[model samples]
Target: MKVAVIGTGYVGLTTAVSLAMNGHQVIGVDLDEAKIVKLRQGISPIYEPGVEGALNQVLNSGALSFTTKLAEAQDADVFFVCVGTPEAADGTADLRYVYSAVAAIEGMQQAAPKRRIVVIKSTVPVGTGDQVAELLSGCPELTVASNPEFLREGSALADALAPSRIVIGAGDPGTSEVVEELYKAVDAPRVVTTRANAELIKYASNAFLATRISFMNELSRLSAALGTDIVTIANGMGLDSRIGPEFLRAGVGYGGSCFPKDTIALLQLAAQNGISLGILEQVRTVNATQPVWFLEQLQPFVPDCRGKRIAVLGLAFKPDTDDIREAPSLAILQALEEKGAAVYAYDPIAADAVRQKFPNVSYTKTAEEAVQGAHAALLITEWKQCVELPWEQLYESMAQPVLLDGRNAWPAQIVKQAGFHYVGVGKS
Candidate 1:
């Protein structure tokens, strides 16, 4: 399969690289000249584990290429729109990027008529693919299929190479078969359905995962008040086959490119349809306040944050990625700064990104550097460097040995024995 992946963001690059690795000749198209140039030189613009190495392998093997124009990939058998559909001001998914990609593909089809599947791998609302199909209805040779990606940020490359499932949503049986044939090399369960179902599945999956996190977060509040361990409770609940342990960790909250925006867009979509997802509404509420709630735990230990040196560990939303978009650490930083706390933050990769938004907060190279002489330390993201530490050394160096485990990644028993005042989310 000669695949053309439009947009060189996380999804597009990973998709292009993975497809090329699977022995398909792939051309990655992006409007950005600099990104294309970098890709041409086998340099990945994004920092995803194993993607750049795989990209270099494919590029060297002549399995992959890069282009600034969609016209360069005119003869491609499959066109994947991996563009970002960012949340609009009104909370709906801004589909301008998607529409632009589709229009470009439409123009390509007109110039050189051929059988090609315009697959919408970008996350969008229900009926988006059908709308795209209708827009290109004149071209009988072109097929529009919704193939939503389920790539997590930290392990995006791995997820793309071996996905949990492959969903192909096409209006016609012929289109479905063609799309399925494109992914024939990948071994995953297939869900061949309508375009609408496929689109909704992407949004619904994120929404449900957000709901689970929020549910546990809200439960953690109860656990905190009752002096019960949320971790133990989660483990006990996970023992039941019906309630498997995933996204059950009670943390400050989930923040990333997906969950925060997707949940809001789903709510907005539901509102437009006159369907009130009250439970999901509450889920968002819990998430919005979770970081603040976690910060409130600091009050009992340090009565006033004024003139206090607070060390914030991990600035990224999650572990590996440098993406600080919608990261909880931002909210924590804001609150700390507002309360007159001299903040020192450290992330192995994401500190530079956060430094742009928060110049006042002191950024450090190492977690130890951030916590040095600090009154308290907060674990915002559970990066290994941020979680695992020289307990005795850190305890002796801190102005006050107060540990607030927002993610509950720190070993409470060990930290307690080390003579640090450990305060964890729902850990008594």
Candidate 2:
């Protein structure tokens, strides 16, 4: 199948590259000339594991290409709208990008030979595909279908290639079949549903996952108050066949491109319909409050952070990628700076990106360097490299060997044996 993927963000780029590697001819379209140029040069704008290699393979094989012009859609059997739907001030999704992409698709339809399948891969509110269908009604030879993507940031390429399921929501059987055929290479459970259900699935999945994380964080708070170990509690709870642990690990909070914004948008959407989602509203509140709670815990350990050297390990929300958008680490860094702490941070891939956000903070090449001469260390992100660091060596170099394990990635025994004052969430 010849496919044209619009908006070369993380989802769009991964979708295009993965599909091209699966023997489809793919043309990635973006309005940003610089990004398009880089893609043509076989460079990925976002950091995702295995994507650059797959993109290289596809580009070398001549199956993948990129362009800024919307005319490239003329030869495409399927057009995927992967643009962003950022949160508006009212907590609803700002659909400017989606609307712009629809306009471009309508313009390209002028020269197309036959009706083309327009797949909405961007996460949007329920009934969005219907709105898109109405928008493109001017183009008679167009069919819109909702095919929401569920790719995680760190493992986007792998998830795209081997998704857990493929969902297609279309108005008619013909539209559903056309959308289904485009994902013929993906070996996953196929779900066919109405457009509204498909849209709600994306929001509900993200919102539920966010709720779980918030629930665990809230439990961690109570566990800490009672001087109980959350790790042990989590381990025991995970053994239950009914609970089955995933996203149950207690941490700072859930933050990324998806969960925070999507949950808020869903809440706002419910509000607009005069429905109050009280549980989801609390979920959002709990998640937002976690960083502040974490900061409060650290205050007693480092009473006066003024002029103190504070080392922050990990910047990305999670590991294996350099995405800091809505990352909890940002809040921690800001809180540290406000208290006059001279912060030194390090992440394997997020160092440069973090520098862009906090130019005043010191950045180092190695984790050891960041910890050296520091009064305290805070583990914000659970990156594998940061998790497996030589704690004893780090302890020896620091002026004061005080460690705050935010993600609970380190072994309590090992960290305590290293002669450092180890503090972990919900662990006594």
Candidate 3:
């Protein structure tokens, strides 16, 4: 299959690289000349585990390439629209990027009379595929399918290569079959459904996961008020067959590119339909307050942080990636700075990016260097390196060996044995 992936953002780039690795010739199109140049040099713009290697392999094999021209897509068998659909002020998705990408594809379709399969891999509102179809009605030879992607940030390559399921939603059965054939080599459950259902699945999955995180965070508050340990309670509950645990860990709420935005968009969608999504609205509210609550918990130990040095470990939303968009660590850093604290932060991969965002704040090359001379340390993201750091070494470097475990990624007993006072969410 000769595939043209439009918008070489995270999803589009990953999809192109993955498909190329699976023996398809892929051409990734993007308007940014600099980005296309970097991709041509076999460099990935985003930080995703295992993606660079796969992309390098495909580029070396002549299986994948990047271009800035839209006409290059005319000969492709499939065109995947993987552009951004950022959240607007009204909580609806801003579809300007998607529409722009669609128009570009429409122009290419006009030049080529052969029918092309256009797949929507971007997360969008329901009926968006129909809108794309309606826009391309003039061409009369294009088929649009809703095939929303479910790739996580850090593990995008792995998710794309080995997805849990492949969903194909189309108005035409023949078009859906053609899209299905593209993933025939992938051993996963295949779901054939309507375009609306496919679009809703993406939103519903993200919203439900966000809801679970909010529910757990809310429960953490109650557990703390009643002198109970959330970890113990969660562990016991997870043992039940009916209540399997995944996103039940209590923390500083869920903040990422997907969860926060999708939850709000879904709630707004319900409101526009004249229905109340009270639970989801509360979920958003709870998540919004979680970071503040985390800051409040640290106040008792560092009441007057003026001129005090504080070490922040982890900047990305999660581990193995340098993506800081909507990361709780950013809010925590801002709050700490507002309290007159001199913040020193370090992450394995996110240090330089974080420095770019917060130039005034101090950044260190190593986690120990960040911890050195700090009054207290806050473990924000659950990076494996941060989780497995030598607590004794960190304690020796810190002026005050008080630790706030935001993600609860540390062993409390070990930290205490290392002569540091440890604090974790929903734990005494």
Error of 2 at 370 (Å): 1.2
Per-residue error (Å), model 3, residue 156? 1.1
Candidate 2 lDDT for residue 46? 86
Higher-ranked by lDDT: 1 or 2 = 1
lDDT by residue for model 1 over 1-428, one digit each (tens)?
Answer: 89999999989999999999888899999999998999999998887889889989999999999999888898799999999999899999999999999998988899999999999999999989999999999999998999999999999999987899999999899989988887789999999999999999999999999999999999999999999999999999988899899889999999989998899999999999999999999999999999999999999888899999999999899998988889999999999999999999999998888889999999988999999999999999999999999999999999999999999999899999999999999887
Q: Which candidate has the highest lDDT of all? A: 1
Candidate 1, which ten residues in sequence have the lowest lDDT sum?
Answer: 175-184
Assess the local accuracy of residue 155 in candidate 2 as a C-alpha lDDT between 0 and 100: 87
TM-score of 3: 0.97
lDDT of 2 by residue, 1-428 (tens): 88999999999999899889778889999999999999888888988889988888999999999999988658898899999999888889989998899888887787665778899999999989999898888877798899999998888998999998998999899989987777788799999998889999999999988988999999999999999999889889989999878888898887889998899899988988999999999998998889888878777778999999999999999998788888999998998899999999989888888788899999988888999999988888988877888887888899998888899987779989889888788787
Q: How many residue pairs clash in each candidate at the backbone level?
A: 0, 0, 0
RMSD of each: 0.8, 1.2, 1.3
Q: For candidate 3, list the clashing residue pairs, or say none.
A: none
Candidate 2, run of 10 with poorest lDDT: 106-115
lDDT of 3: 0.88
Regions of model 3 farther than 4 Å from truth: none
Question: Global lDDT of each model?
Answer: 0.93, 0.89, 0.88
